[model samples]
Target: MEKTFKNLEIYKVKKAESVQEFYENLSLNRPGLTIPSLDTLYDVGHFNVFTRGNCGSTGPVSYNRKDYYKISLVIGEGILFYPDQQIVVDGPALLLTNPDVPYHWQAGSEAQSGYFCLFTENFIRNRNETLRETLFSRIKDHPVIHLSDAQATVFSEIFKKMMAEMDGEYIHKFDLLRNYIHLLTHEAVKICPVNEASKPTNASARLASQFIDLLERQFPIDSTDRVVELKTAHDFAAKLSVHVNHLNHAVKEVTGKTTSDHISRRIANEAIALLRYTEWNISEIGYCLGFEYPANFNIFFKKQTQSTPKAFRKV
Candidate 1:
């Protein structure tokens, strides 16, 4: 799986954060930071836990995906922005996010505190198949479960146990940690069961949902060498093995937007994010976003936002 990730053209787009990059970003954002045995996290099947502040401030983040699975226990208030909706987590909450979902976390206040642990798929692979599917599958909605005080205490104690185990010298400690992760998932299931009821029921809704998922999978274009592969309605229709007209009708029926409209809007959003947050030159950004010419990207950006990419970036 790791080899597939490295070789896949889609993965080269750098839409998702790798574990190494996650720490590197930490070091860059928080100077003089020190985390013990950082080198060990590079290995496959790695797992680690940290207190919220120890990880870093829960500041606003660009909407993006992670290559690893993460479970966060958030106390106090914060806002989670997914592409489709915004969720305000107002109290103690258990948040689960997988590799397939892109989201942004915006801190509400300094009062927020809790624990979060992240691990690669290999970390729990082959050990418990049921637990793996239960926790890491695509969580469509309700990924954040608001917890009562007693429930929060129960999860808090589990995280405390994980922290204690990490500090201890017990051999096979990770095995125990994996069990804790499993326990956490089971406990969360008790609060909110993962079910298919959240999925779209009708045909048009399903096709539209699939189209949106496929579109979202290609986003936050972080690398200059890679470009979005599915750019046109025909491209998406072919990939989904449907007629272009059929796909277009379904999407319009369900989303109230044309196929080209969704594509262009998403591409424009990525263009803005790259222009705002990245240091890449205009041409590099253009090429990565599937515009072969810098002039073309400028035109598209202007058409979408009524401002040239250069001028937008300056502002």
Candidate 2:
């Protein structure tokens, strides 16, 4: 069957002849994925406030998945759940969810109010280089933020000002919105708590973070580089300037997995992406994923995915 966003409860806002037309055409019944073309969809905009309603569904809501990034300021009670985490917003809080991951929410019955702004990812990404990571990373696992009353007041005022600007005939209203978004991002990150447990101050946590950073930097691990560095836990430990045991301890302490587990998971994640997204042959994909021999790659892939690379790719 052909994929459609209507199958999934997703709404795409296309540029309309008038604001009334824009709102009237908003339909939240789509499925699969929607990629917004800047020319056709960028002009549609809304400054909406919702109070006391369920989030409508219990599935992942992806912002960038359908070509937009959604920014929501929670003014009431709700809980957003991702696969591995949950964020409870009981008061004024600003949350940003990227389209890369799926998210869902369950709002309380006692009147949940919030301001929502939807815009194309390109529209926001063009304004700042770091926004891709800041806005879209899996960091929403750490999304619930505690804002002081004063800070919340400031955010409210800014939202009101942006709403007013949208109503005005300013030539640079879009530019102003861009700046306002940047400000909002800064404020959200400032109020959000650091994932200290995830990034421990202890010797082990420090080592694990460094190891993870290094591992991530060496993504799409080609066969050539794999032959040189990170072929084993000991190799990774030496690079991190720590003993293998210490490195393993750190990784296990922070991630509940050994150094080898992290390495295997990283390799597996890359392999899955390659299998699903690219048409590379299994052997070539294995080579690119750092296996000297296709057989070795096959075994590793099977161990991690419970199926051969080809089988997993088919699914």
Candidate 3:
């Protein structure tokens, strides 16, 4: 049954498409779709916005990730598919996507109209690291935000501003565009502020909090030059100046998950993201994840996800 799943449609994987490849496929699929010069796009770090005309579908889009981030003002109903869940939206909505997640959008009706913008991370770098981190962190956790008519109008106006800025030839247009991107992200946060569970007060909770923060600081794995260093409970325990058993007790007591469980889950998430978004071979990905042997990575991934990295990247 596991072997059969390799050929199953639901288990099939599509590698994330790059900006150039996205436009190439768009042109091939939607003939006569005029776009700005690709050269200009790269020179400006690749940013573009579009108004969805006549519903915006060459056909049903498949489940896949893109190499860029996207923010969309969805005006109609649709279903969004994640790895383990799906969300249905029946009205105006805001959709946020990052390079870390693979998803598919299926329209619920024929009448769909909205605006969306796609841009590389570097395009939005305004020296505000906090803003950049907040943007992608919120996007990865909550990709869909249902919108009210008033809120929809606000996002729509923002998109219009982005479109207008894109068409202009100002000397510092990219900087202006970055500001608009920040505006959209900040507005989204305002509309749907993530509710925080109260802060940790006890010593165990505080220690667990520190462990989680330290673990998360090594994430997303943007490049292969650096690899995850602390993989085992002992490693993290040593770093935190606690015994492995004590660390485990604190984390399990506070987060209801063992130190190993938290580490494994985070590493698994990064592995999946790297597998779906990168062209690196299975061995290289394994090495980047701190596996000295390909077989170890395969076993770990299979234990976490019930699928091999190669099998996960079917395409």
Candidate 4:
């Protein structure tokens, strides 16, 4: 069956559109997966259950390009779709989806049983290193890894414990749940292939992936207060701790495009989206796109698309 966001429902969080809204759209919350109100999570995140026969339809889900990350323990069959790839989850699997990448899923099995935790990067607090690990970056190609029965049991217990603590009046339950999330991901590394779960094959691919990931993560501009970063190849290289030449060569060899081309293309795409969807003035749009002056943005837009931002917006 075909599905779209309208056919489902628009979930609201904090009386606005936020990541927590995605958590509410699911029709079923199994017994063990407890979801606290979005308002209650002042600084932490939400934990929830995923059970089979929950939501009626299992088709393509709308793309999510907001803040927050999700880790799901799914038992059943499903197809995880990315822009470039799709993974088959024919058995119990551990899946990680981050804000940097957008994906949708389709169910293949008649029954689905699992637990999923949704949280932002801030929820983990001190362990920012865990969030930046290589494991989270393989969303497009290696999104899901089928788990052994024993491994599934281990993860299932962790989710149960998380829900149990949440059910109690324990004050640091969120913190404890964060630790359990770490434990869950840490255990998953053992099951995935040694090569795929770790760093890339070559230094160039590593630099290319890092650069692309860093660039992508800054996007979907969650709020007007937020603006684009890493607007230039040199800025991206500096952030990646690599020389500009090295970064350029790596990106070109891996992607068949120069580093600047990627940046310009991404920025141009954002500019178009802003002009088309937002009511912001040209200056505001330009400012958010890292353009210091309106004229400069106008020239760049014309160069990229043969039309000025104002002119394009009119069309």
Best by TM-score: 3
lDDT of 1 at 96: 85
Q: Rank the candidates by TM-score, best first.
A: 3, 1, 4, 2
lDDT of 4 by residue, 1-82 (tens): 2322235332212122256555555424444444456642422334544333533244335544445577788887776765
TM-score of each: 0.57, 0.46, 0.59, 0.55
The sequence of per-residue lDDT tens digits that candidate 1 reaches over residues 182-282 is: 88887887788667437776898899889987987786575787798998999999999999999999987655468998788768767766776689999
lDDT of each: 0.74, 0.58, 0.74, 0.67
Model 1's alpha-carbon lDDT is 0.74
Mind sharing the TM-score for model 2? Answer: 0.46
Model 4: lDDT equals: 0.67
Q: Is candidate 1 or candidate 4 better by lDDT?
A: 1
Candidate 2 lDDT over 1-315, as tens digits, reads 113122444332222133233243343432332333333232222233222223443454432122245667677666665435556666777666544334555554356555666655434543113233443343444545556678878777777777787778999888888788777776665666445414334676567778877776666544433532465798888887788888887776555456786678667766766675567688887877668799999999888757788767655
Task: Give the worst 10-residue stretch by lDDT in candidate 2.
Answer: 42-51
Which regions in candidate 2 have their CA more than 4 angstroms from the true location? 1-66, 127-130, 133-141, 193-315
Task: Count residue pairs with overlapping backbones in model 4.
Answer: 1
Give candidate 3 misplaced runs (Cα > 4 Å). 1-11, 35-44, 54-61, 128-132, 196-315
